[model samples]
Target: MRLRVHTLLFWPHLVAGLLAGLIIGVMSFTGLALAFEHPILERADRETQQVAPPSPGTPRLPVDELIARVRAARPEAQPSAVTEYPDPTRAVTVSTGRTGGVYVNPYTGEVWDWGASGWRAFFHLMEDWHRWLGAQGDNRPVGKAITGASNALFFFLAVTGLYLWWPRKWTWRTLRPSIWFRRGLKGKARDWNWHNVTGFWLLPVLIVLTATGMVISYKGVSDLVFRLAGETPPTAGGPPPGPPIHVPVPPPGSAPLPLEALFVQARKQLPAWENITLRLSGGGAPRGNAPQAGPRPGGNEGKAEARKEGLAPSTFAIRETGGWPLFAATQVFVDPYTAQVLRKDAFADLPAGNRTRRWLRFLHTGEALGLTGQFVAALGCLGGLFLVWTGFCLSWRRFFPAKPGLVSSGDASTSE
Candidate 1:
């Protein structure tokens, strides 16, 4: 009975580990690369980051002027938002869309075209690959299903691995080899020891990483989590309306609120705020709307109301203090014309489930603990890769023992 029970658990664990490892190995490798994505991209954009501060006594350019300048530079590429930095030396970013943006010196309006930089493009591609195996744009059904299911399986493997790594004897003698690397070890013993020890230390982190990944991958699980937390998922009924439409242009000669005024209002709400990025609805002809000049080539005058309803509003993201810098920022919506604050969704205000959900990115990437956290997460990925290799070695040797004399015992041990 004892032998039978052990076999039952062992075989399933081994089989699942092998299958999940193939997918997780790729995910882990990409994760290792993504761990330093922000810093890497910053370095890549060093030229833009090093912009000189405005000349002495030169005032920062007005937000409206900057918008006009950007529009003149790329008429087809509408201005969606501008990200201002606290550092005077750094220029504000003007995003046209997913693939285009420019860095303009707030003081002088000197534009640095980051719209088509190779490094930025490469990282964008890496992000897609990391999230969905480059699933051809974000959240495609095929890519999401593959990643989501595999991620859940990886979580299963981690849990079972912990059970298997537990020492049956429960003695210091038995525990030492499982917790620490052994020196002068050889063949299968070394592989087994490495796999066990690494798994022992990294199991907790692996659980966090894989579990959070599942929350991001599946809506049902996410909704359940929110329900458990006594809150409804943000988009309970339908997908959150496509990114807030840009606010329509205010009347001419009205002189909309200054960007500085809005920044001051945001800072007052959170005194420790460091950075904020504001995205304006584009003024140029909104894409997907009927042709402005006349009816379509088909000569059909589209419904005017539907076209009006399609415009997105302006929104700004604030980097709140005491939260994950990359992922915990608060989202603020504003009336583009009046610059009136419409709503604020800070970290603390989020539902318990949503709050937990927000932490998923930081936990997965190990950014919650800053550089050290990132390093540890990267190490976990490396450890995961090793686990796959050593796992395959151990599994193969056990399942396919060498034929009696076809392979010498000594050679077989060495190969294992």
Candidate 2:
């Protein structure tokens, strides 16, 4: 293929496929493992807290009741947000998303494990290694760079893989033997089928994952995507805070909002909301983002139809405790004026754009339709590991050269 002529013969991609393949393998398996982590954690955890539950058939505690309980339990720690994981049996995770002291609760509220239980620790390590190669320092100086390079290599790999999968030999008979495993080939042949066949089956899902991940991992790649889509870079509004800081003790007269009361009132306002996340009371951390208006027409409902023309203008301001620019589970902001609960991204709420970008991001993570997508993506992850292992075995056998006693697969004896 023209693309194969352009790229596979090149230096970086060939080196990339040969070396970076293992990094891809680790990243894939770790993601897959996390896909199944919730259930695994619950199964391993012991009953640490006693709880009183609603009747058997009664719905799990209303978001209102749950918020009340969590706030009451940990008054010192600010109740930032509540997450109801998709799994029914697993405990609801009330994460600060902080590394040192995040907690997990099963039913009413019970603590899970620290490092030993493998409760997100191992996954986090693999994440660090796969992203940063176990680089020193919390800042992940080396890991960030490696992650960026791997993302570039992955995109290149995907394009080259398409070329490689094509049957360059042409004849069905000749290609059939090559693409399909012969009854029994020893080393290279065995490894080839594992690599080629496994990869071909997982090609679509992995491609989706790789492409979307590339968008997220690389700043330049994402900017290019936005430009291609004709969307402008979002402008930042205020002087950004420098570093993350802990909640500062209030001055003699500084009064913090009563969160419990806020939750009660919020429910009174938006009965439809399933979740709420709050910003922890803190100093030096500007409570929230300044409101960006008119662009996101999402506050207090009731506006005049353009045809009729008679409605009050909607006021726009950042939702109080809204956290920072790109909020990923740390804290999702809720507008103070409209009480319009935030954090409903496009893919989760409804379809957006003609291309599958929205759905594809979901599909990329296998998170499109709740837990089911997560499970499918997990399988893709395992398959990805197998692909990596097989690719390595094939390349190793080819480059290093095995001894004479070690029979090569492409031979008849390999079938055994």
Candidate 3:
């Protein structure tokens, strides 16, 4: 019975690996490349864009001055957000739009036209391949579907591969070869040994990676996770709108609060902030509907009316030291003119389901656990590459076995 069951599982496993091996290999290689993307990009940025202060304790240029300098250098650019690091050596990044930005030397107010590094472009390409097999335009959905299905298959392979790799007779003699690499192996022996050892040791990490990937790729799977956690799934489109809060109105013809004031408020809000990004309201468009001076909210109706009158608030996303889960940021929304914090959304305020979603999202890339997790994930990807190579070798030898007294260069390489 054991032999029969093993045979049944073995055939399906072999066939699935054969069918999905190429796509799996692509994802694994791309994932490996992307594992250290954050650190790699940081190093590249420092090497190219790091600046020095003229003297010790020299205060950096004001945020408003930085934006003005960037706009003066590129008249066509609309500055939308400015990210300030606590480290004075780091340049301020004034973003114009999504993924468009320039690094500004805060000391000299010099706007550096820093284009994406080759490593950044390479990682972007790797991400495209990882997510959608490099599909573009209308075909992205199709590519996404293919990769998602293959990811699900990979999860199955991990599970079954674990079972198949387990020794039926538990002993050093039975298990030693499967658990470790052996010398003097050739052809089928070598391939089989590699396939089993790699699969067994890396199975847990691969399972985690593939399972999180499935959650990201399929809404149904994500919703199921939320359901399992007894939390309602977040609706499509965006997070459900938060309850209305009273936004203080500024008198007509009053200039908006200076960026300095907003930064002060943000610092007061999160004293331990390591970095804070101030995103301008309306993409820094002209504020045409400046609110007339009015009393504070007297009731819920007044608050709703304030929100309806285009008193949109700019936001500060603050990343502080020792933040749990590593990826969560605190969002502070302040009225543009009043500098009154309308709302603050901390990580603790997130619903359990959304928190779970965030964790799964980062865990897919191993960022949730920091650099160590990323390294482990990269190792898993490396093991996956070996598994695919060995599995293909084994399958090739099975279908096209060596004939009597037949030897070729290709055969010699495979046998080696």
Best by lDDT: 3
Which segments of candidate 1 are over 4 A away from where they belong?
1-4, 115-118, 137-140, 236-272, 284-314, 320-326, 342-344, 403-416
Worst 10 residues of 3 by lDDT: 290-299
Q: Write the per-residue lDDT of candidate 2 for residues 87-165, one digit (tens) a residue.
A: 3454443434353223344345444333334665775776666567778787686677766666567667766766666
Each prediction's TM-score versus the true structure: 0.80, 0.63, 0.86
Position 238, candidate 2: lDDT: 15
What are the per-residue Cα lDDT tens digits for candidate 1 across 1-416? 64566667777878887777777787888788778776676777877655775678878887667777887777777776666766778787887776577888787777768732776777677677667778774556677677777788878878977777766688998789789988777556777888898898998888988887887787887777767777655554221222233355566665445666665565566666656666554563212221211111111112222237543333456675555544566666555446566556665654556556556646878877777888888888888888888888888777886677664333433321
Candidate 3 per-residue lDDT over residues 1-416, each given as its tens digit: 87788888989998999999999999999999999998887777774467875597677777888888888998988776677877777788876765567899989998876554687779989999998999998999999998998889999999988878878889998888788987777767778888888988888899999999999899888887778877766565223234565566677887777787788888888888878776554445322121111100111112344557656565667888897758777777667687777777776775666667778878888888899999999999999899999989988988898786654433353321
How many Å off is the CA of 181 in candidate 3? Answer: 1.1
lDDT of each: 0.66, 0.49, 0.76
In Å, residue 228's CA in model 1 sits off its true spot by 1.2
Pairs with backbone N, CA or C atoms under 3 Å apart (clashes), candidate 3: none
Q: Which pairs of residues collide in candidate 1?
A: 81-279, 245-312, 245-313, 246-281, 246-312, 246-313
